[model samples]
Every structure is written in C-alpha cells, then in structure tokens.
Target: MARGTLFSSIAGGGLLIGIVSWLAGTAPAAGVQQQSPGSNPPPLDYSLTADSQPQPGVPTGSLTKHVLAPGKFFPGTPHNYQVYVPAGYDRNRAIPYMIFLDGSGYAGNNVRVPVVLDNLIAKRDVPPMIAIFVDPGVMPALSDEAQNRYERIFEYDSLTPRFANFLIDELVPEVGKSYNLSKDANDHAVAGISTGGVGAFVAAWNRPDQFRRVITWVGSFGNFRGADRLPGLIRRTEPRPIRVFMQTGRQDLVNYAGSWYLENPRMAAALEFAGNDVRIELGEDGHSNRHGASMLPETLRWLWRDYPQPIAVREPQAGAGRGIFAELVPHRELLPPPSNPAREGGAGRGGQPATPPPAAGRGGGPRGAVYALIYRDKPWEQIGGVYKSVASPAVDKDGNVFFADLAENTIYKSDAARSVAVFRENTRGA
Candidate 1:
C-alpha cells in the first residue's frame, strides 16, 4: 500500500515505517500534543535544506520491504521492516547501517529518509550505508469486529532491553540474511522520534555492542515507562560506548506523561556529564518531527563522523554532575586481579571477572588497550597552520597561534585572522 520510487539494488532492502500509535494517538482533549487529523501538524513549519531535497546529479538508492511475522520476541505480532541501500551499495562488503525504530514516518513520506541519505551520500557527508526502517509489531485481529493491538508503547517506551534484544537476536539476523550488514557497534546507528526516539536511546543504552550511535528527536523521556530514570541511570552506570545526537523543540510541551522539551536536555546533560559524545539541537518547533527531519542529513553526518574508529567508554567527567557520576561503577570484584574474592580477574577481555592483574598486568604484553590511541569526537583538528615540522608551539593571550618550524629554522605566527606569516627567520633550528 506504500508508494514511492522503489529502485532496484545490489541487495539493498529496508522497510519504510509509518506513524506509531504513540505518535498518532492524541489521547482525546486531555493531551494537547497533537492536532486533529484534518488540521496542520506543527504549530510552525520548518524549512528543509537542499541536502534534504533531491538534486539532479545526486544518485538515489534502492529500498525493499520485509516482514517478520510471529516473531519469537513478541509472539503473534507482525513486524514489517524496510531497508534502503544507497547508490553503489556494495553487497560483498559488510557496510555500516542505521535503524529507524518507527519505520513508516521516517521511511515513508514524512521524513523521506532514503532521499536525504541519497543526497548526503552523494556529497560524501555520510558514507554509503543501508537503513532499516522497523515498524512496531501489530497483533492480528481475531475477527472482523475485533481490533488489532498495537505494540508501540509496550516496546518502544519500556526501560528494559526486550525490544533491543528482539532487534539483536531476531530482526538483525533476519535482515543480515539478505545483505552484508556490519556487525561492529561503531558502524551501527539507531534513530526515532517521540516514543520511537526514547526507544532509540534505550536500544543503544542497553546494547552498546549492537549500536553505538543514536539520534532521538523529541524523545518522550519523562516518567512514561520509567524513562524518567534514564538520566539518573546514565549518571550512575558505567558510561556506555555510545555517541548521541538529540533534538527537541521548545514548544514540545508537557503533558500528563511529562515534558518532552525538558527531558531531552536532561538526557543530553547526563550524557555530557558522563563524558560521552553528544550533540543536541533545540528548535522552536513542536512535538512533530519536521524540524528534526529537516536536520536529518546533518544528524547523520554528525553521528557517522569519523567512522571506523571505535567508540570507547569514558570515565565520568569532573564537575558538579561529574561529581555524581565520577565514582567507578561497582564491579564483581573491587580488589586487584588474583587477589579479589572472585579470584577470576586478569583473565578475559578487559581483564577477568573482577578486573584482572593489570591496572598493570592483564597480559596483552604492553601496548595496553586503554593506552592505545583512540579517536573520540574531534580527536585531532587542523588549526590551519601547517608546516613540515614544528618543534615548538605557543598561543598568545589574545588567541593567536605561533609555532617554530624546526626544519626551516623559522618561526611563524598565525594571527586571529588565520594569516600565516613569518614572525622570525633564521632561528637556526631552535
């Protein structure tokens, strides 16, 4: 029943999702979050960028739909998922992929995600990847008059890992049967809006081994289904290896559930407080995903920026919120390896059950894993002043950069205007 330009692919198959029950259901006049079906959705409209629109030279991708009926996780419910393979997607190679929790809206006309991905891929802003638009399961109607039950709220808004487990244990493996999907968590991303947005974060939070990048648009993060506990959980638990991009509108007001606008910031603060990589955009739109959709291209770019690099777990930061999250999480054992009660330390990956011998010992023979050079956000930046070899570098009080070129035996200064000129010549390699 869905219609669009469905291009053929080298095995690129992802489903398009529609509105979620949580998103589409406006609980009568008691909730002012949504408009009547006939009225305009957002209070104010957002402008889509050129990247979000199709261009003549840009190449589009192929999209295919699939269904997971009577899935083991949610028995008797039918879940339909879609995959979008970008132009020139290589089926032979295991390519990075992203998941859309609530499929229809994003995969369908509302977000037109495949179109945006095509444009960004053309510009090389984001790598050529596959997208999985997974719709929540719907129970079959028992009879002509019996209504089918929607599983959106139960699955998307829950604090537990059941939904994520379904994706990992069932949906992903099923989809992987068709395409060479990346198994690396760093190569995976998850996204959603509204309750789907909460679901996205919850997925990455519970299963960082499956997805490390997350984007949530106007996530319903309040008390509904214990999501209000996320900020506290993020602050208390060991920092997960995840990167997040979030957006919320000031007008995404409070309801009987909680404040959409407020919860997003709380989530962002907790992520930042834990020293995780996170970016958030606050706009003037409402609970709708229009503004977030407009920024989708940028969001993908940010989420997938510096790919192939491993996303590492970080120690909590050092500040006020940091003070709360700074303490190391409880491990099975507290003592050093070989001495702890568990006595099984210094044995496995990241040491043994109790944290193995090395703080100094673990066994990889130096070249320590933690000491290995890892790239986080903005790992290394080019500050414009480039020379063959720099022996000394200094910055002025006013922020001008000065460096000495060792081989050239000259010192150069890059002023605030970013102009590189010789400050002193013939320094004699000092």
Candidate 2:
C-alpha cells in the first residue's frame, strides 16, 4: 500500500480488478459469453485511472486546523485533523459537528466541503456547524521488508464500534479540550465516500447516540470486508437515529463485490425500510468525483436540516403523497375558461349580439360560446410578488376557476369572468 494522501492509497494493481470482478460476481455475466473450459481466471485490467488530487482555492471561513494528540490511537505517531468551524460558532453555545472519514479525499478532491460549508453558512442555507476531517491512522513498521499499513481495511470495513469509539472516546475529547462540543448524537454527523461511506453508515448505525447525520458517496456495500451483509442486517435491525444522503454513478466499480449502483441503492432501500431518513441520487458517470462535487452542497443542506430533530421512522402513507400532488392541474383548467354573459347566453360577433356559437364553444350551437379553461405557465405579477406559472387548477360550482403553481406549489383562483386571483402559497408543508 502507498503512504501519501489517503486518496493515493487506491490499489491500482491488476489484482484489484480481479478482486472487484469476483466480488461483483461477474462470472454470471461473463459465463453467458461462452468462454473455453478451464480458463483459470479472466485477464485483469486494473489501469482504471481517476482523479485523486484535491482541488485548489477552497474558502475556509472560520475553519481551524488541529493536530491530533500523539499517543491517542496510533500511539507515538501524530496526525493532523482539519476542523471547519462555521460562522456564529460560540464557545458558550455548543454547536453541531460533522466528522469526515477519508478526510484527505473529501477535504481536497470531492465536494470541497470546506468551501461549500462556508458559502452555505454565510447564506444561511444551513445552520452553523463544525466539520472535523480525520485521516486513517497507521501503525509503525518493524522493518523495510516487514511494514504494516493495513489499518485502512480493518478500521474501515469492520462493523463493530471500534472505529466509532476511537473517534468519540479519543479524538473527540481531545478536540473538546480546545473547543466546546455538544455530546448529543443528534448534533453530530459522519460522512465519507467509497469505503469510507460504508464506514460512515456503520458508525452511525452502531452508535446513533453519537452520530445522527450521514452522507455517503459511492459507498462500497458489497462483500468486501464483510460488508455484504449490511442490507440484511439493516432489514432486521431496529432503526437508528440517522438522516442519510447517498450518491453513486452508474459507471462506478463493477466487480465481484457489485457495482456501487446496485449496492448503494440496495443499502438505500434497507435504510428506508429501517425508517432512516435517506436520500439517494444516481448519476450517469463512473466511479469518479465529478458527480459528488456537484451534489455536495445540496446534500449537506438536506443532511443538516433540523439538526437536533430526532430522525423518526414513519412508514410512508400509501396515498398521502398521491393525494398531496395528484390532480396537479385540473382538467378544465388546461383550456381557456368561458366568457361572461355576452359569451354565456348567446350573441357575440363584432360588437353585435349575433347568433350564439356551439354549446362548448367552437363547434356551432344555439347555446352561448362556452370556453374551456386552459392551463398556462406564464409569468404573472400577483399579490405583490412574481410567479412562474399556475397549476392544479380547480373550478367552483359558480364556474370560478383556480390553479396552483407547481414551481412554488401555490394556489391561484380566477373568477367566473376569467379574472385571476392569488389563493394560497408556500405549499408542500411550507
């Protein structure tokens, strides 16, 4: 294994491809290809190159740097932990915090969390919070020929609380020595991408009392490191205090362990089944940082919404969402509404009360011209505000028509004479 930035530790050897294929169970897909008998193992191509460098010029407002206390986890070896303290952080008032696994990767390459956090906090898109980026610890090597840096797979892949404990019992208290931190789990979040993503979920699942928010990008939930059983476990285990955000690309790794697409969605289903507040986004790219970078800011906003609010596992009502958004635009409202008495009774031709048109407008009939309501997405100035469009229109017994704006989920009403009026706005539970 290499020892530079943790992102550089990706095993680029050919064995990794073979390992991935085997883990993803490519045999079935390959078996259909009809190969010769006794073809030991397929040729491995592990030269899959991807970006592993952190981007430059990230804004770090109020973020502080903290060096880990030597002799804590990897005794006698010191490591650096980067902390991003959001604006309005008060020593007298404890604030929420986030712990980033694979710190070197997230802090540098993907999402550029420091910059996003700074901008979001400044704009009040999310509450002020702190982020602690910690890298994996390495054990001392006995000799040049006999070295040990395998801690990544062990600490990251394990389902036990050892890793979580290392952070809460050791690293956290050490940081507390310098700053005030709320011990409430709801005030804390843990996040990462790839292997670290799975590790983030595991930490929160094992100890929700210490971490209630989780964000994972391209999480490896496959059989590697005994993580393949996570879905089944989540199905059986009681729900925990976790609001999760997951993202993966269709082109992500496809190996014996399975594509991040298949595994991440499966984990998402499990999380949702367990009543965890989870959001999963699928992309079209491969195992890369591009999508993650684009989604980071929004994902963080969703995760930290209502910080201390305990994540509840309420079964989604079968018809609640349907009724909530169904009948988006009323049928009659899709066309122009009928006119007043002039067009209502009969008569209407160049200022002269000529013969009436058809019963339902156009066609030709004795009854006045009955115009149909038509829906439109036109910009309009109403109620002292500007609106994009009108949707979910309804008509009253008196022939008054109304509509709601899908963009803002607002309702608008029009008189029987086709005059538009503002009704209710700020819908979708406001």
Please provide TM-scores, in order, for all candidate models, with all chains considered together.
Answer: 0.66, 0.60
List model 1 lDDT by residue over 195-273, tens digit each. 8888999999999989999989878888778899998998777688899888876566455556665677667767865
| CA deviation > 4 Å runs, candidate 1 | 1-45, 320-430
lDDT by residue (tens digit), candidate 2, 255-286: 65655656776676566545567766655444
Best by lDDT: 1
CA lDDT for candidate 1? 0.69
**Candidate 1 lDDT trough over 10 residues, lowest sum:** 1-10
Candidate RMSDs in Å, in order, are 20.1, 19.8
**403, model 2: CA deviation in Å?**
54
Clashes, model 1: 15
